[model samples]
Each structure stands twice: as structure tokens, then as C-alpha cells.
Target: MPVDNHDHDHQDRFEERLGEALHQAGGAYETDRRALVAAGETRGHRLLLRRRAAVVAGVASVALVGLGGALLVPGGDDGRQSVATGAKTPVASATPKASYTGDELIGILEKLLPRGEFSSPQARGTDDRLPPYAQVVHDDGKGKAAVAVGFDRVLPGSEQARQTVECPDKVLTPYDGCVVSRLSDGSALRIFQGYEYPDRRADTKLWTADLVTPKGQHVSVSEWNAAAEKGAPVSRAEPPLSPARLRTLATAAAWLGVVDAIPVDPKAPTAAPAQPSGIDGGAIASTLVSLLPKGVKVVARSGPDSGYAYVVVDDGKGRSLVQINVQPNMSDVEDQLFGAGAETLADGTKVVTHKEPGEKGGAGVVMWTADTLRTDGFRVVVSAFNSGSQETAATRDAPALTTKQLRAIALSAKWRGLG
Candidate 1:
């Protein structure tokens, strides 16, 4: 996989500490419900949550993985229950876990990313240039599994600390499985394996773990780390992680301490004057889609804002919309765009989301709101939404648009019946 060493280095630092988390989980509730494992058999670190929250389908869900696909799903609301303070406890069992084949770890990994295949770790003698951050290891037994993931040369720090400013543009281009790009959160993940990388090596296992241990089975991360130390030159490949598991990784402060930050309210209603309107929904959706930057698409749209664009689409599944907006203004649309820390553009475009009032967790459309006076007399409002991912509520925002430009886009979108 073509991962940035900078990202790898950063992940390395964090993973090193990941070992200590084991002792924390060892103290309590070991007899509580066991980890949702794959049938039976296990190895490596046992994953149990004293309090693990599942991603609510509506508010926040898992997202597409791979290179380029690894972009941050804008900070938004999580419908899950509020978090409880505490680390997960290991499974309770007076008996020490008997060493088993490495299948148990493999199974946990398989669930974490079911789309993946199995393969041996990289052999030290291979002609392939191994990633310096490539450290793939697992325990033979002890029941439980945790893949010690790593990235090469990539910024190794908190997701918030590293913004997208460090990545290159072509990183997102095709022809390569992984394209490095900045995300709203600041951290950049190289989509390796088929997720995003050079070889797309739909051909390497790169990911490994032990078999699933029986439900009562569990192990600590520190214990697993010590055991994995005995293994060397583990495979280095981009492993496919389950969207759900990936969500846990992204939101878990322990792994990355990733917190969910969303602009519940708008940036405060802008002082900009309202423009004309009349462009219907169809016209608005068509024009907005046409005007969007490449690689951007529309997932959802609304009617025109009284006289401005009124819809936002994180992943443009189809067209755009124009509608009434009731959310507060976003702090800075452009800053949120182009990933975090993005400076204002020369055009002075304002990106905003049309959120439901009093709503929280970034649930709304994000687009450029605009109003234009059409020749027909019906004024129209339009919003171009084509940022973020489908899994995030940030898609509903629409801002930085004007009536005039919206009308132009609407004009182009006007349906002319074929003769």
C-alpha cells in the first residue's frame, strides 16, 4: 500500500501507548457480557467495552473506506447514548487463555473489516519495499484480537492536531488506490489495500489476527503487545475495516480520542442581502450539480431558500435543491471546506447549512445559498451541496450562494422540451 510515512509515524506513537490500555480494562466487570466475537477461537488483544456505544443509523453511521475514501466524515451528531466514563474490562475467567492457532485474531479483524482477505505477513527477504511504519503483529493465543494498525510517514498525532494542509492534491486522483487529502478533522489516512493505495493490491492479506475466542474469552492489549513482540516483519497492507468498526475507531478517544464536533447552530445569519427567486426545484438541482467542483456530488437537496439556494449534499447521490432554511449561520463555511483551516476564497462565497432549529450534531444541508430573479418572474433560491459523506449529518448545509448566480444556474437547468 502507498501510505505516507508521516501518518505512519504518528499512528506508531499512538499505537505504542495503546498497549497500556490493557491494564485499564483488566480491573472491572470482566464477567460482564463478552465482546461480540466471531463464533469461537481467538488471539491477540481481546476487545471488550465497559461501555461501547454503537453508531445510530440515522444520526451517524459508518462510511466508505479506502484511499480518498478515508476523508473525515464532517463532525456531526451521534444518535447513540451518552458515553460512560471507564475503559472496557477483559473477559472473566480464572483459566489463562490456552494458545490457539492465529485464527481467533483473524476473525476479529475479519469482522472489523469483513471485505478483507487473508495473507501472511511480509517476509523480511521480499524484494518489495516494506513501509517503515509497517508493523503487523498478533498473538498465537490467549483469546481476543486487536489489529495494531499503522501508517508510514504520516503525521502521528491527535486527529485534531493535524489538519489537511500537509497533503498534496494529486493524492485524491484516480489510477491509484489511495489519494491523500485533508479532512475536516485535520488528520489524513492513506487508503491502503483496496481502500486507497498504489497497487490496489487487491492481492495482499496485509491484515492478520487470531481466531475468535469463546464468548467468555478476553485478553488485555498490553499482554497482546508483548506477545506480538515475538513476531517480526508482520505483513504491511491496507486492511479493509468495517464501516461500523471504523466509526468506533474514529470516535474512540482511546484509539485516537476522536471526538464528534459539529456546528449545531449556523455561523449566525449573514448580513448579506437576499436576492430574487423563482427557479423551481428541478432547475435548482440541475444547475447546482453543474456548478459543483469536480469529485463533489449531491446527496440531498431542498427547495430554494426564500430567494437563495436552500440545499446541501455531502455525497451528491443525485441533484440539488432550494428551500427555506432555519438553522443558525455556520462559523466559517470555507474554513470547513477544503478541510479544516481552509482560508477564505477570493469570490467570498459563503457556505452554510440549512439545519432544523435547535437541532444539534451537524444535522443539515451544507451548500451555497443563492437567490436570483428569473426572466419568468418567479424568483428562485438555490444551494449547491456536494461535500462530506452520506453518513454525516453535515450534508444538509447550503451557504455562500447569491440569487444572481443561482438564477444563471437555474436558467441552464430549465427544462426545454425536445421538438
Candidate 2:
């Protein structure tokens, strides 16, 4: 997968906040900061794949991750009770001394679990300068399982928060079940049962619960049948936790203080402002459908609000996937996206085409793209895949639409009105 430096920077901010929170919590658990950052970058890249798939589903308009809150200390007659369902501990204040240490947080998590034998436990405390994380290998006699919890925040009132709790479009996410609920405290929670990968290429089942407080504190918990996220063999019928337990773990009041202790980084760059609004995604899909060659038939399309749209079309041969991105005032990067070998129209529109192997690595799949930038900076780039989805094997010999047809659609005057 390609790494977007801008997105990587955003992920770094999240990691920094998490590390700061862990350090404030004060724990014996410690690891090299460089290793942590490297691991985070790998995970962030995988997450971007999911985020991009969400975009195709029309739910992700803005970037998804952000930072906020401090750490929460375990509290109760017994620290474990504070994390139990219906425990109702008071929300933690912003004082660092009052929060639980990393060791205490891990103990609290262990106590909250059902009867099970836990091994290979790992945790980062509230006082560690690394993102807070806890993982345990659990065996209930039936089988061993892996469960983990992570902490972070969302940009309040942004599309990121909304997408965090929104149930994914089934076609894009391929989950067995998913539900989104609102708590009495006005926090949003979503529980999803799905595969570790969206395409279900592997048998590792992933079940996750995500909670976002009204104030932007975000907590996520995930479990897999295998001991690791990938490669490990499935060790049980399903993940160790039920949906209700997942919710309780994510919303535990014990985390509130830790979230409160996370100090914002003065040196971190402010999130880039949302790009200048673009033409609606639905309009783009509709226009592309309208311009399809006579024999081509549109099968499915995405909504207009996503800034990009795709259509599955068939033309007697087989189904193919064609997608387009529409942007306004993108002249700043025209030189980079369209380099040498580009063609310039009499009207000052620059066009470029490329035939490359599929990005998803689907066998025998090919991608043909047409990119266009007008004199006024309006840009339209279109690409077609020989497969129905980039992640799947090719369903046809080639894209349903030829390169000439794609270029014609990209350069059409109709796109100018979209600006």
C-alpha cells in the first residue's frame, strides 16, 4: 500500500498523544519509542486501507483519527469493579496525580474479564510516553484467544467522529453483524463482527467495539480468534467477548481519567483544514453513468457526497469497476500528478494516461487511468479496473471501458459544470 505522508503525520500526532497519556499513568511497562512509532506506522497503513474502502462507501469525507483527553485511573472499592458494567464511577478530572498508572490499568482490565487463564500479557501504563495499549492471550478451556484495547480521540464535531460510530456499508466492509447505539451519557458506541480483512481472504474473525464520548474521547477494543491479528491460526469458534462485554470494556469509566491526562503537543501541526468542497459524489456517479457507451450497462454506484464515485458496468463481456475523483483548484499539484508524456489540449487542459497492474494485487487484474487538469485548475481523473473490486480477482479480460472511452469521459465539457 502507498503511504500518504500527510496522513502519516496525522497518525504520528495520535501516537504522540497516546504515548503521553501512557507515561502520565506511571507504569513499569516500557518499550523503545522508535519501535512503537514503527509499529504504529504499519498499523496506520492498514487502517488507511479500511478508511479508503469506507470512502468508496460514502461515509468517510474527512480524515478519521485525531487526538484529545487525558488518562483515567482505576477506581472503586476494588479497582476492577470500576470497569464492570453499570459501575458508574465518577468521570476523572484533568489532574495527573489522580489517574491510574499503567500497571493499575492493566490489572483493572484483567479483573474485568470472565474466568479465563491469561498469558503473554502486555501493557503500557498511563505514565509511559507511548500510546496506552493492553493485550492478553486468554484461554477459557474451550480455546485460547487474543484481545486488545487501544485509546485515542477524534476531532469533535467532525466527520471522523460520525464515521467512527456509523455502521459500515456491508458491501464495502463485509461484516457478519454490526450495530451502533447511543448511550445515556450521549456517547456513541458501535459493535462489529467481521473479518480482519474487508475481503474476507482469511479466516481470522475480528470483533470490535468502538466508543466515542460526546467530548471526543475515543476507545476501541478488538478481539480475534487467533493469537495475533494475522497469520496465527484460528483458536476458537469466535472471539472471547460478547457484544455486551465489548461495550462495557470500551466505555469503562476507569479510562476517563487517563484520557483527561493526555496533554496536547504544542509542536504538533494542526490538522489541515478540510479541502475546498468538491462536486457531489452522487452527481459524479450519475454523470459517469450518463456518459457510458451505448452497450455498457451500469450495475451499481456510490453517493455524491464522498468526493469520489464508482460504477460497475457490463458490456456483454463481463463486469468492470470504473471510478473517478473530482477536485476543484488542484493546480498546485498538477505538475506532480501529470508529468512528462502528458498531452495538452488546445483549450489548455492537460491529460495523462497510464496502464498499470492492479494496486490490490489481484491476479491478472489491470488498471487503466485517464487524468485531466483544466486551465482553471478543475481536475477529473478516472480509472477502470478489470475486476469488480480491486481486492478481488479479475472478472474480465480487461476493463469494460477502453482507454479512449475513459479519456473522452474525463475530458468532456460536462465535468466543467461540476466545478
Candidate 3:
């Protein structure tokens, strides 16, 4: 099936960073046809695993990472080339023809899997409208599992590439085990054992091996205990493939030829724009701490460089998590984020309060949010959770701060200094 764009866009920072890195590395895929198969596999794999993890913990910190703007390029037809917007030159001449079809690539994947009975096979050819991918339900005598493999690229020496191989902070992302290592061939590789949901509310497990060659060839292999990534029950204790097997699949030579067949978009490198300037996380956290109500004791704080900050506080009762995001020039999204129910103050500041369930679906965990926007396009949104992390159990019956207090803090004059 074609990848879901919605799900892809909402992936956690780790996956998104990897995607950006791959795009940068594969800028020359089209012109270099000597290794077409590898290119195709690389591109398809990147797209397929776009949202492999969206609800992971510590995503707030990850969002603070800076990235450049990106220019999206639509897939082109067989005989045509899609030129990137703002290109100063014409599209380059046709490169070598792709040697392998999508099915041929899938055939290569099937051959690489360990001895097993494969069923529910679905494969996309290299020439297909959507990025190509191969998926199957493999039974290795123990249980049936979903396994998939695809290809992508990353720019060597780019910030995106450097961040791609970095391990997620354990405090922000709770994982069973994660390893980053350099292969003998000098390729950077990461193996992660993590749950599909950061909260581990379900039994679904996702394991992946991400590899990027020095030349920017990217290959990712993923497996799950369920038949599908979501809406499926866990079929076994773990995925069918082991970390060793996943590494073997990702580093296979067969994929290199296929990756060369994948077309490259001239705009891939230009897609990411620079990060927006705003208040530093430390300042935001300090400001919030100073504005807290008396008798509330802060136990911990997070967000140093990010524009968002959070603190764990106790109010002679239980612990609560309070977080805030400070953004500038956000008038463009004012209407969408704040509706007609929002109130306007004498100072022309619009404010809205929301009481909703925790984003991670933790049982009995509630969230209270106060959103405020000044006429000058300054936005301050503060939220409090009954729990320290959305992935964990509720530590308090309610957030330490009331909605009124949250509203007051969000609209404080102290925030104007950040401007």
C-alpha cells in the first residue's frame, strides 16, 4: 500500500531526521545509474518507514533540533523529468535506464530472508507512482510476523546524517536496548529495540536496523510482532528477524544495484528550511519557574536550547508535569489553533483554555492547556499534565496548576521580554 502521508508527517524526530538525512545523501541517485537497484531500494525504504514511530517519548526535545527548509518534488513519469522550483538551470539529460523493476527488487528481498514460508506478499515496482517497497508475512515455524525492507540515502557529513545515528536520550525515549556501531565497511548503523508506542500501552514491538554507507546509500529493515504496523494483535513475543539478520539485510550488496535505479529529486537538498528563531528553552523554563504559584516545588526541569520547556512540580499532594512552548510570528496559524471560543483581552491578546485527555492515551491522565496569542503574533501555550510523562501512569488526580493560573502565566508580561 502507498504510505500514508498524514502518518508520515507526524513521525517522531528520530524518523524525520533520518528521512531528511537520506534525502540529502541521495542527491546524485538519478545521475549515477551504475548502482540503480540500490538507489530504488533506498528511496522506497525511507518512504515506507516514514512514521514507524510517532508517539515516542521525549519528542518535545527532539523537536528543538534545527533543520533547513525542503523543496518537495513530485515523482515524474518514465519519459519526463520534473524540474525543481527556483532552479536556475534546466533539468539534466536522461541518465541510464533503471535496470530492476519493483517486483525484481521484491524478488531480491525474498531471496535474502531466512528460510521461511512467506505469504500476503505485496510489492511495488521501481517505476510505480509511489515509492517502491516490499512487505510480507513470514512464518518461521514459531509464528507469523510482518517484515519489510526499503532503500534511501543521506548526505555524508551533513547535520542530518550526524543526528541520524545519534541515540535518543533515554529519559525522553524509553527503549529496551539501542546500539550504534560502525561496520567494517565504514557504514554507520543503528539497531533499536523499542515499542511501537512510547507508553507501551500495547504489546506491539518495532525493531529496525538503519544503515548509511559513507557514500549516502541508506537501507532500513523493519519488523513487527503484528501482521500490520497498527490495528493488529501481537503474533509473537518478538519480531521474526534478529538484530544480526536485520544488519545482514540492510547491508546486502543486492540492494546497492537497486538503489542506483531510483530517480533523485533535484529539490531534495533544498526541502528543509532553517529553524525558526524564538526564546531559548532555558529562558522559557526560568520564566515559568518564576511565575509558578507559591507552595509549588519544582523537582526537575527540561528544555535547555529548545523553545519549549517542562518541569516536574509538587504541590503538597502529587507530582505534575507543566510544559510550555514559546513561539514568535505565529499569526498565520492563529485561527486554526484558536477558535471562536477564544477570549480577547483589553490588551488585544487572544486566549483559549482546553481540558483534554493526555496525548499518549495514558489511563486517567488529564491535560489542561492555556493558549495565548498577542496581537503582534507572539504565542505562548502552557499545559499541565497529571503525570510526569504522558507514557507513564498518572501521579496526581489533577494538574498542580488550575486553568486560571495557567492562563495567568501564559499571559504574563514577563514573556514580552522574550520578544
Candidate 4:
């Protein structure tokens, strides 16, 4: 979404002040400009990624977070760290998601292949504008498989988004830039890549290799380069298990939990106003603020774009932290998608990312960009972490959080309340 100055004096003032505040922050100017360049270059990246050239990583918000399924996490390098307990996730033997049907998958194939051929097309690397032949193959790791036959002027991502809309029976998860189907059989198939932000000129062919635990959770190894030529199809080694942990993977991606966790937008009017959760939006912000260094004075705000009343508390010093987001009881997948990080791992997934050098910050840092979703009646919680400690702190806490923590943060967090 692009920001426009609509001549609202209040908005203009806020923008003016915000800009001045950013300038005072110094490095934030660079961060903001770099973020802008990354955002604008999205479409251009897809245009240039087809040369099979080596790609480089750059700045991006919400880059993939890895839920590493390591066989044995080293404990303090002394070979004795007790691994942290597994985070709870949903699991069940999926028959294949009922949301999509076989016919829909075939339709997607028609667009990818030439006459939707079963075998590789006669032309190799020629500019004939070939269509890919899609198939629901086996052995693709997440329990099912899918393959696209060719790429003669075919950009996987542009096509993947189109296919997702038509194929409702499947779970469409985007990895790196390519897309994949989270099949009911507990497998994922690579489709194509989408546009990556920050530097479209950096690279294109996003690749993903998927693995689904017997318990049904998935893990993908995604790379944004020539996915096929430079890598193995899917390489994996089983992780030692806890039977209980395995059972959790079979369930859905916990979209329901995420829905249950979002706090209602304070700005949305009740027509029939939605029921208020026990906790209000302020708690989210307050909780967010509370998590920071003591004595850090913060200016707070509440908004609806994020599907959760979000609180961004900025310490008067150049550093900041996004503390809380509260959502009311709602049962929509779209909100869940927008509101929370992935609760379960999926196939064809990768953990690729980009960040500023010397900055070391990574995914999940709240930003002003999440604000635009509000116009559509969404709620957003935006937070900026203080420099240095920001990324180190968030990544460490992300996977350790339980469903209980997620819900409590939304339902019980207290904020500086004026909604």
C-alpha cells in the first residue's frame, strides 16, 4: 500500500511530526528510505529474476522465521543444554484439505503447461512462453507433491497468487517467492515464486524443499535463487521425537487460535458492534510497553488496521518496541493470516531472510506499514524494538511462546487506555 498526503491537517501534522521525529533519530532515516526502496522494487524483481543468475538477499519486513527441526540443539556448546520444550501446535491426520478439489489443481496446471503436457515440453530454455504441467505427485515430503514442468517466461509467483484464488481446496503458503499447496495428505508441492521486496533486481527464482513430521507439522527449506539447478530436490533427516509433540503437527495451522487472539479494533464502530473481549486494546500496548527497559517513556497509539488493537511504545530515545496487539473473538482466516506468525510449519517452506548490515535485526519487528490494513477495517499492533537488543530479543522469544502466551497477550494485556 502507498501512502498519500490527503490534505487532512491532522494527518499532515502527524506526518510532519513523525518525519521530524525520524530525522532526530538519524539512522531511522536510512531505515525508512531503505524500506521504501525495498517496497517499490517488488514488481521489478520478478521481471529480472529469470536469467538464472545468482541472487543476493536484501532488506525485507516479515522475512521467513525458521522453526528449526534440529535433531539435537546444542546446549550452551558444552553439549549439555537441555533443549527448550516444543511449542504447542495443532496436529491431525489430514485426509487432504477439503477446501480444494482435484479439478482446481488441474486448472492451475492448464496455465503452467503447454497443452498441459505430461512430459517436459520439446523446447528447453527457449522463449516460447511455455505453460507448466502440474501434477499431484507423491514423495514431495509433506505427504503429497506437486510439480511445474517449465519456465519459458513464466514467473512462478505471479501465477501462484492467481492459482490460489481459483483453488480453494488447498492451503496456499508462500515460501521465499515461490508458492506451494499445503495438501491434506500432509505434504506440500512447490508452485512458483512471487515478488520480494527491497531489491527486485537482486534475484528471482525462489525455491523451497518441504518436510512434514509424522505428527503432520511441516518444515520447508526455501532459497531465493535457481531453485532447481543449484540444489537437491528435498533433503531431510528425521528429528528425534516426542510422541506428544508429533501429534500436534497434524492439526490446522492454528488459524483459529490466531483469530481468537486478536483484540477488536478500537476505532471500528459497532453497527451491531462486536462483543468486547474481557481485555481491551490498551492492554496490548501497555503489555508491549511493560516488556521494555524500565523508565522508558513511550507515546502510545491504538488502531484497527492490524485486526488487533496494537500499541507501539517508543522510548523517547531513538529506540522503540511494539509491545501488544489485542483481538476480539472472531473466526476469519484472513485476519488470522494478517495477525499472527505461522503456528505450524508447512511443506516447501524455507527460512530465507534479509536485514541491514551491522543492524542484525530480522523478521517480526512491527512497523508503520501495518497501519494501512486498518482502512479495510483491520486491526494492527505496531512496535519498534530498540536498536541492538531488538532482533536478538524477538527471535529468541518467538518460538518459545506457547498458545497460552499468545492468547493471554491478547486477552489480558493492559495498556494506556483511551479508546
Candidate 5:
């Protein structure tokens, strides 16, 4: 895909853990359900809980294979229920001692959803993984859609919690609408209406609600106009749930109980990863603007996001989106990123250039990139897209900045002082 190895490394870590969980549970289930579980693992990469620096999907659903079996039964007005089959229990914690069966979690989801005929139900329970979730193909007489809910825990005042509610930049993620608010219980909620494909290659709509409580309980609900997140035809005008309904489903008391059931990871890190002390995004953007070829004017720019920045520029033709990622101590992945055909500067710097189609799926979009690494393991990668936003169709034949201009920007000496 010609993506940065550093970002791919983060995604790999998450996928590896999820793969282990699925492999352990695949044997006990029917083949169809097992496939459903695998689909969820693949879709999990798009969840909003991931690091923004990685450029994953802005919002999506996650499904995981539950570890053990459970007996299903019809339940009250909400939905069906299931009782765990085994006696294996999780370690004790102060949050809540209750455990849930995969079927029980699915039952809870049905209860929260508007009256609908649900099929292909799949889920993971508190006894299975850190973040448990449920998915169902639902039809409310309008059309078939896929609805899901996932639960996890984040530190109350942590960066993850904050980012969970923050709206992603429109330049990076194209969306119809988004709002973040504080609930009565001091929880934060974000309701997002966006496309299933950021580039809008398909008309499928994706709507999501994310709620983070003061006690670290995180619940997210997502629905798609189609029966699947990817590779499915659009089956309706919109997702089955409205913004209000998504809010109600995600904040249900039943979900709080499920989130409470998740076991605490004794080895989990207590804080966010530390970054280079002075690596400021604002400085990076300013430096990029300063290095631009004459006559190229900056139109819009990103805020001071630490270690990442972008600018939309025009040179009398069309707007182009340029972005940079500056990182320190990345020599560990040097071999993986700069393999053969990479150039070496006299000062022990490795440089590589790429001309390829855009990765974000924007139609007719192209991307030009320059990646450089210094002897101190400092890395700077800059990319210029033919379109001002990756989620939109291309507006020009080429980016405002040529590959040589991009290379000059990446190799500029100014980035050294910023970090």
C-alpha cells in the first residue's frame, strides 16, 4: 500500500492481539458465524479508539469471537439472553464483578435497537476480551443494515478519552455532520454522521455515537446503510438508527454493566506514549509553508497537533493537501521502511520518493511523497495529494507541489530544530 511503516506497526500490534483472540474461539462456532467474527476483526481497524496519527477510519464497528459457548433464550421487551457455559471467571476488580455471555450482549443490543428483525448476530462477552462488542444484521421494515455496539475502558482524563470525543479534521475525514457534548453524568459523547468510505466511492452511510464516562467506561455504537462495512452494496438511504437513537443505544445502563465486567489489565500502561519534547505541529506547518516554492500560496492549515501537520496550498491551478509526520528514534524500522533503491545523503540521511495513487480511495487522486531519515533516527515524511482533501474527488491532474519540491521540503534543515 506504500504506507508508512511506523503507522503500519501500530495497526499490526492491534491486529495481532485481535487475531489471537479469534483463533482461540474459532473452533466452537459454525462456519458462517466464524466468518462473521472474522469480518468484525477486519472492521475493528476502523474504530475511533485508535491513534489519529495512524489515519484509520474515523468511525466503525468491531466484532470479536467470544471464547465460550452460551445457551440462548428469549427475553423481555429488550431482546434474547444467554447464560455462560463454563465456570471460568475473570480476575476481580472494583468496577463490577458481573460477567456477560456473548449471546447476552447481543440480546442487550437488540433491546436497545428499535423494533427490528435481527439476523446473523455475533458478539464477544466481558469474559472474552478487553473490549467486548456485538453485531447484528437488522431490518426495521425499511431496509437491511448492520448495527453494532462495543465497550471498553480508558483512563478518565487520558488523551485517548479526549480524542474519543474530538472531531477529526475535515481535511482528513470527510463527514456530513459531527457534534461533541458533555452529558449530565460528566461523560463525553460524540455523534458522527459520515460515509462508509471516506472518499465517497460508495454511497453507503455510516453513523456512530461514542460515549466515554468519567469512570473510564467507553461505549460506542455504529450502524451502516448496508449489511456490511465493506464490500456490500448500499441497501438503504441511511443507517437504520438516527443520531438520537444511537445516543440512547450507546448510553444504555445495560452497557455500563457490560463495560464494568471487563477485567483490568495488570500490565497495561498507565499513560500515553511520550513524544519528542518540542516537536510541535504548528512549527512544522510554518516550516513547510516557508519552504514552499515561490508563488504557491497557503490557503488552509491544521492546528498545532503534536508531531503532525498539514496545509492546503494553491498555485493558480488547484488546491493540494500537503502533510508531514515528524518522529524521533525511528531507526528501529529503518530497514523495513527504506529497503532497496533508497538514496543516501552525505550526512548519513536516508531518502526515498514515491509517486502513487492515493491510499484513501479518492477517485482519480494521486499522491507524491518524500521520506527522509537522519542519523539520529529523526524521520520526516511529507506527502502532497492532488486533491485538497483525501476523502474528496481529485480536482487537478497533479498536486501543487512536484516530487522535487516535496523532496526539498522533507530534506529541509528546519525540521531538525522543531524536534
Candidate 6:
């Protein structure tokens, strides 16, 4: 329901670093577009699968890798692209596009920033496999902080573009302040002030300015109160850049040139994917609320996120977080999920119940779950937490809903009709 940062397993860390390194490699190199596009699409598919695992399995650390996209950075002193991973060598492209090296982009960022000491600079050029970005630890005579800028493209007037600037729901992403404005040139800009950890488990602050132009150019500027985004103590009261400065930096005209240099992925879907369709998030949320037993009222809820929904309800005792995920064509994994101890209904639906410690690392927190898979390969799982948020300490001894209630909710006829 919400995002949190915690220690990840060794494999998770390896994958995260690999993804970051691959994205940060940049240079003026060329390769067969067809092959690269195929690889990128393959990566995109894997990314989606990982995201689903994060949501369903509560592997919060895996979700921190990043939103799927390439990262572009600056070149070296000799103006040659720097490779972070040294995994791929670019041959030659039959068609070459005008682009900026990582060094050039970093130079622009240095010139745009206020007088300050910069260190730990990292970049990827426009011609890199991933989109370009420039990052550095900047000290503006105050405390050290990390500042970064990145470029990408979105379909104009599409849901992606709109969501790029839309403020997240407070229930899902607790933040200090968020502002969305339209620039005179018809671009959308969002200035967000939030914590690096949504639950305020840590004091690190993250502020960002996201801009999307009418023609689909996207520029994002982000800064942190600490020298690094994670695992660093707070270095200052706030990030080095103010909201106005962040807006100015992200909207800089120089970034537009960088964005224009990025080539459109030939294999990228022009429209949304066709599969995995069912009830909308709004319908799911409405259905969840309706299923709640008496004496409980919804105190907070999530936006319609399609196939997943959550609500925090308060009984006279305390607040609890309940969430559900509905999936179609899940029979392939049914054997792994529904084991020998699982109960089988007369109609052939498999049901399993689990009582376990919360995966989010909240002290004293517990999770009660009800998992079910229909004969048609449709799966519905319902879980309830003893705390209002999985990241916080438990407020009560148990979740407001009993395991039986969760099972009933998961097996409800209402869910079958929706799917």
C-alpha cells in the first residue's frame, strides 16, 4: 500500500546495483536499433513482473531499483562516454542522431547551479543506452546535499504524462507539500516536498521538480538533504535547492535539447498493453469498502491503481490496514502458492491461510492473510495488518479483521462478477 526502505537481501542488492550501473553508462556509441529495442522490451517485461512481486510479496526493497527507463549522464574530461558496468560495447549505427555527451550535460548542470563545491559527479551521455542524467554532491556553503537531473519522453496528453505531474495520494505517499502548476508554454510542472521514507522512519528529506512539456519532453530535478538518497545521515535542514530553484533548474531550456536527443524506442508500446484487464481500481475500492463488517469505518484509502486496492479502517480498538490483490490467469503458479495443506472447495477453488510477521519490518506488527485461487485461474488474496501502515509499529494486538473475515472477503461472489 505504501513504500518503505529497508535492508535488502544480497540478490536484491545485486540486481539493484546492476540496473543502476546499466542505466548510468553513457557515450557517443551506436548499435543495431532492432537488437537494442528487443533487449529493452525484454527488460521492460521483467520489470513489470518484479513490480508485481513487490506488491504481492511485500518485498519492499525490490521496488527501490527504479521506475523502468534508461539513465543518461555526462561524459568524461576527454568528452568520451563513461561506462559504469563495462558490459556492452557499441558498434556503429546506420542512423546517427544529434546528442550530447554525459560531460556536456554535467557541464550544463554545473553552470546552472549556484556557486558551490561539487563532488562525486556521475553522468551518462545522451547517446547512452539509457536516458541521460547528471548527479553530484553539491555544497552551497551550507551542508552537503545530492542534486540530480534526468531526461525522458512521455506520450503527450497520455495518462503517463498526467501521472508524471499528478501529486500522489497522501494516504499512499505522506509528504510535506506538493504543488502542480502549468507553465506559460503549456507544460506541466510538479514540485513535491516529501521524505525519503514515507513513514518518516528516517529524517531524510527528498524534494523534486518534475516537468513535462506539451511535446512529451520530461525533465526531472531531485535533491536530498543528505549527500546520498539512502544510507546517509541528514546533512542539512533541507535540500540545497528551494522549490523555486528546483522549478527553474528542471525547466531550464538546455534540458529541452537533451530530451530532444533521446530516440523513441521503436518497440515501445504506442498504447497500453492489451492483457491483464478487469475491474478498475475505483470499482475494487468501492467493493472493498462495501465488504467491511459493521463497527469499522474507513479512515484512509488509496487511489484506483487497477487490480490492487487498500483501505485503513478504525474499529473501536485501533486502526488496521487491509489490502487485496486480484489476478487473472494465475494457474501457472497455483502449485507453488497453494500447497498440500491448502483447502479445496467443492467447486475446486484452493484456499490457504497464513499468519506471519509483517514483511515491512515494523516492530510488533503482524499480518493475517487469506489466499484463494479459482478453478479458472483467477486468484484473490486478502491481507490485514495490525497497524495503520506496515512501516509503523503495531498499534493493537491484532488486525481488526479476523482471518475468517478476510477469507470470506477473498471468496466473495462480488469479486467473481467483477473479474
- Using TM-score as the measure, which candidate wins? 2
Model 2 lDDT tens row, 324-359:
877666676666666778899998899888788765
The TM-score, computed over Cα atoms with residue i paired to residue i, of candidate 1 is 0.23
Alpha-carbon shift of residue 17 in model 2 (angstroms)? 14
Instruction: Estimate, for each residue in 97-151, the C-alpha lDDT of model 3 and write its tens digit.
Output: 4666766766777898888888767665555433456678788888888887665
Better of 3 and 6 by lDDT: 6
Candidate number with the higher TM-score (3 or 4): 3
Give the runs in model 2 whose Cα sits over 4 Å from its true position.
1-50, 54-100, 266-275, 361-363
lDDT of 1: 0.26
Task: Judge candidate 1 at residue 384 and give its lDDT.
Answer: 34
Each candidate structure's TM-score, on Cα atoms with residue i matched to residue i, is 0.23, 0.76, 0.71, 0.23, 0.75, 0.74
Question: What is the alpha-carbon lDDT of model 6 when measured against the actual structure?
Answer: 0.65
lDDT of each: 0.26, 0.62, 0.62, 0.26, 0.65, 0.65
The parts of candidate 6 lying over 4 Å away from their true place are: 1-97, 157-159, 271-277, 361-363
- Expressed as tens digits, the lDDT of each residue in 148-193 for candidate 4 is 2221111112222122111111001112332222333323222223
Model 1 regions more than 4 Å off: 1-419
